[model samples]
Target: MASQKPFIAEHIYADAQTGSTPILLIHGFNSNGAQDWDGQQWLAPLKAAGRKIIVVDLPAHGESARVDVPEDATVSKIVATLSEIIDNHGGKADVVGYSLGARLAWALASQRPERVNKLVLGGLSAGDPFAMLDYDAARKFADEGVTPEDEMTAMIASMAMGEGKDSHSLLNLMQGLGREPFDPSVEKPAAPTLLAAGLEDPMAGSVDAIEPFLDNNKTVRVPGDHFSALKSDAFKQETFAFLGIAH
Candidate 1:
């Protein structure tokens, strides 16, 4: 893993030895790149398949420095950051994002269609209704100086997990994100795209909410809830196949 200072910002990277097709992996809210990918065992198979990988920690998360433009830092900032990394590596690359990362991926694919070759969005939808409520609640929490360890965070975890269990880690993450709007509008993507969510993910709820936003893109539903989606081997295979990398 290497630390990259691009766009005057610091982010972590894990390069693949074979470097076949470059794929950028973006982590979810409150989670770092390694914690998201490594914890789920998603990166190893991609590496073994000879695919170059790039993982980034979003602003206010992981080793990346906090941005002064938290309110201004919409999903577009994430897209620009990935664009900068892809440009530094080459000109274009495939992108894979989970949760909040997936939301950013959608924004990136919509904004800079040419910069991304392929895209995979996991555990989220472009205009998920649940996300709007979360956005409001998170903003309120941030205003109240509440950290991720707050009751609201546990509620979110319970909802996303669909098991009615509280997660301290999830609360800490919500606090880390501070307050940001969750806005996912319809945008045409220039590359092949895939949208995925856990079958029981309360956050995503149903595929119906996402279908209208996707421009005829592929959708995959794997077993489990938000946390378990990453653990699904079926998800890994489908994701790798979508990126055109052998599993």
Candidate 2:
């Protein structure tokens, strides 16, 4: 059975306001809330704008490492858990997410449209990349330091085996989520949305497939690749502007 430990969340309330709808920030795969959102300079400015914020560490990542998700977990299952983050607050929020977090946020908004006010999704495309990963090769390479013949497997293995990362847990997470690959057409959100992807990011090259689903949306190209896109000033400014927050 997957461990039922709760996800770790940090709530930062606006100094001058108490009842405003908060913003929920979700980070990408193999990343923590602090490094992804706070470290990227997202928190301070949002606070300055009097926006209450909730930052969460996804299960099996960062502070929530002890929370184990099964190998058969589906996107909807994880989405259900994320919805609790909204429930604990005011039952709804504006969401900002990047990469794998973008996929999850997309699922969250679709699964619970009423819970999302506005959405900012960055570094995302239409499908799940994890679905094509060579799990066996990745596991062997991560466990024994053997080189994986498959390039994608090797790359994912290298990422999972990084310092302070739990390769086994990360692999488990990827395998589970890949069970239900992302398909935007299945369920689309009704919230006003902003989609941003790096100009050189191949991972998000197929973002056009997701555009039609967003009735009220705008798309922007920021400078940087997948890894560096989150830190791009253009991406930050666009996200802040779309959310109506001063940055």
Candidate 3:
């Protein structure tokens, strides 16, 4: 077996001039910072907030496509690397994350509470989606374009096959993430948080399930499904209010 390389994802500061405490945007599975935040039209509003912005492509995704994910890696390892992004900047940030990004944000806040000012965790649910992934089925679909029999794997395939996506690295990320499943009850963050989920998004089951895990938190149901929620105006409004950014 070949040894795995150290995990290093790509990150970029989006603003030309430095301003208030930075806002770090983390994208979800099968998506990159550009598609999730830039393409979804999130940067403009954030820029108007008059704060330094930092955007990151998670390991094995987006600009970080070449980054190798070790089979035994866990979310903690990624969170630690993300923490360095914060440390390299101003040593703290207000985080906004969706789906898998939200899961990682939660872990980052819990592990390093001092580094996070506030959190906007969107499209998060109760159970671990990675744990449910059919790895072999997902890989087959990725490598050979064979449709997966599993519903979740099929759904993932559709998203992973998008333009410029590295399906193989994404599958490897899923495999690593499945090794340590996400559980909201463990190691919670005390920072003020806003948990928003789309009303019709099945992936985010009962957003309130996560309320107990956060000390200062608010939960709201926004319009649209998982994908649409990222682009929803309601989501932006609620998050902006929580972060004290103007509408």
Candidate 4:
């Protein structure tokens, strides 16, 4: 995992010999780029198909710098960082994001439609302001030295899980750091998009609520609750297909 110093991103190059379209994978809250994709075995198929891949660790996660910003980090800051990465790689790249990362991806695509060739968002809802509010409160709790109850922790872990069991430490770190909520006033994405959620997920309501806002989008339901869905083969298949790669 080579580090990008100023941006705090971890670059993972694909093994494919030929140059191809690049795809950026953004992980969810509490989880870094590697943790999100490691269990799903997403890279192997993408690399096999000859696509360039770049996975990043946002501000507070993984090897990135833990900067002290507002409880809810601004979406513009994230977009700026992503834009810089795309520019460095030429001009544009496809993007796939899950949970918190998905929210950022949506903001980025909306802000710079030309920079994203294809976009996919999983485990998120555009209509849920409560989700954002909860994140803010959680961050406050972390700052105040309050430990979240077991139920609350379980609720947080339900967002996304791959192969390994959920880690309380990671969830606590993310909940405490907090994330910015989505602003509906932002422009909707114009790129080809795919939105997905787990069938038994509590967040499913949020995903359904936001469907109308996506200009060009398709939706899919996979097995398991929120966390379990991340490990689904169906998700990987659908994701690869949406990115125009042979699954």
Candidate 5:
């Protein structure tokens, strides 16, 4: 039996400037806020700008580790939980999400528009590649150290077994995420959005895969691959400007 807890591990960075709207930071799949933002030196600028920051460790990731996901834990449920977090903090937050976090953030913008002000999506595709992945394959590799020839499968398996991470919990989380029917074209989130795609990243088809969906987004090309993009200096510069932190 899985714990009924919401698995909300939150950390707050208070602004020196009073009444500043907070920005929510959501990390990618198999990553944590500490490594994604704090460890990567992102929090410094936000803190210096006197903007409150909120970072959450999503289910089965980082500090919110539970081996099994709750039965009722669907994508919608997770979005709603995030909404409540925003509401509790100050209401109407700006969101920044990377990869898996981007997917959830986009859903939040659609389903709970009132909770979001501006959205920033990084390292995202207009598709759900994870759904096509074999969770069993990833799990077997993590549990038994069996490697997969498939690049994506191998990547996921490696991340699942990262330092201090639980492979079983990742399997449970990935299974739940696999059930989500995500089609960005069919269901677009109408919000002021920014897309940070890496030029060398395969996910962006070398700047072609995202062409169809760039209508409303402000796209910026950063130098790096999928993982390295998060820590790119160009990405940080563009992101800071977009988020309205004056140079």
Candidate 6:
């Protein structure tokens, strides 16, 4: 069991540049900013392009920081933290979020459109099953590495654990997200955004399920599933191009 005490999110800046509008990178569940961006080799190129990269370790993933409160891992809270980051760096920047990070990005752009310039939401879909899960039961099943009754949730749990996440902490993350149906009633994310999904990736959900609800959007299909897609150079190409910093 890891420390449950709330803490500040860990973040790193690449090539700190004054007055240069930064681009924020948010990683997926069980993964940290280093693994998703720097480890994946995305950081160097963006740095070379003279872009300031602000990579965040979304609570308890990389650099092991917790939210302000144990129960504050919700998208709203995540966005609030992110807003603070953007504020510190001049209050408006582009954003790139992967998987679970993408979900939080959606909430951020929808709720704080002015804070985002160009948005790239990678690995997302219409519904989030984690919201429907029984946190306690799922956490227990995950600890055992098996949930016979619900294969999907079990696999998701396994994936989270595979990323080196403690089962209970991951459960806390999902719980902060709460169990709420996808809300289209909220204002659509107005930022210039791209929805990037891999054809083979069902784990990230379906782009079809929610793309229709978003305006000011472009869609791109890269060559790998959830994890691999992020590792793909094509994915990087798409991202760089969408961010308008592509070579």
**Which candidate achieves the best TM-score against the true structure?**
2
**lDDT tens per residue, model 4, 1-247:** 9654454576777665445678899988767888888733888788888877889998666776654444333567768888888878767888999877788898889898889999988887554332333544444444554444554543554442334523333443354334444654556788898998999888654786777787789999988786777778888889988887997
Q: What is the TM-score of each candidate against the true structure?
A: 0.73, 0.91, 0.87, 0.78, 0.87, 0.88
Where in model 4 is the C-alpha error above 4 Å? 1-5, 16-19, 127-180
lDDT of 6 by residue, 209-235 (tens): 677787789998998988899888888
**Arrange candidates by lDDT, highest first: which order?**
2, 3, 5, 6, 4, 1
Root-mean-square deviation (CA) per prediction = 6.1, 2.8, 3.7, 5.1, 3.0, 3.1
Segments of candidate 3 deviating more than 4 angstroms: 1-19, 67-69, 145-149, 162-164
Q: For model 3, which pairs clash?
A: none
Q: Candidate 5: global Cα-lDDT? A: 0.79
- Evaluate model 2: give its TM-score: 0.91
Determine which window of 10 residues in candidate 6 has minimal summed lDDT: 4-13
Q: lDDT score, residue 179, model 4?
A: 48
Candidate 3 on 111-226: residue-level lDDT in tens?
99989999999998778877888878887887788888988879865676766777777777777877778887768888899999998999896687778777799999999999
Worst ten-residue run, lDDT, model 2?
A: 65-74
Give the distance in Å from residue 206's predicted Cα in candidate 1 to where it truly belongs: 3.1
Write one digit per residue (lDDT tens) for candidate 2, span 149-172: 988778876888976778888888
Model 4, residue 106: displacement in angstroms? Answer: 0.2
Model 5 deviation from the true structure expressed as Cα RMSD, one decimal place: 3.0
lDDT of 2: 0.83
Runs in model 6 lying further than 4 Å from the true structure:
1-8, 16-18, 66-70, 142-148, 162-164, 180-185
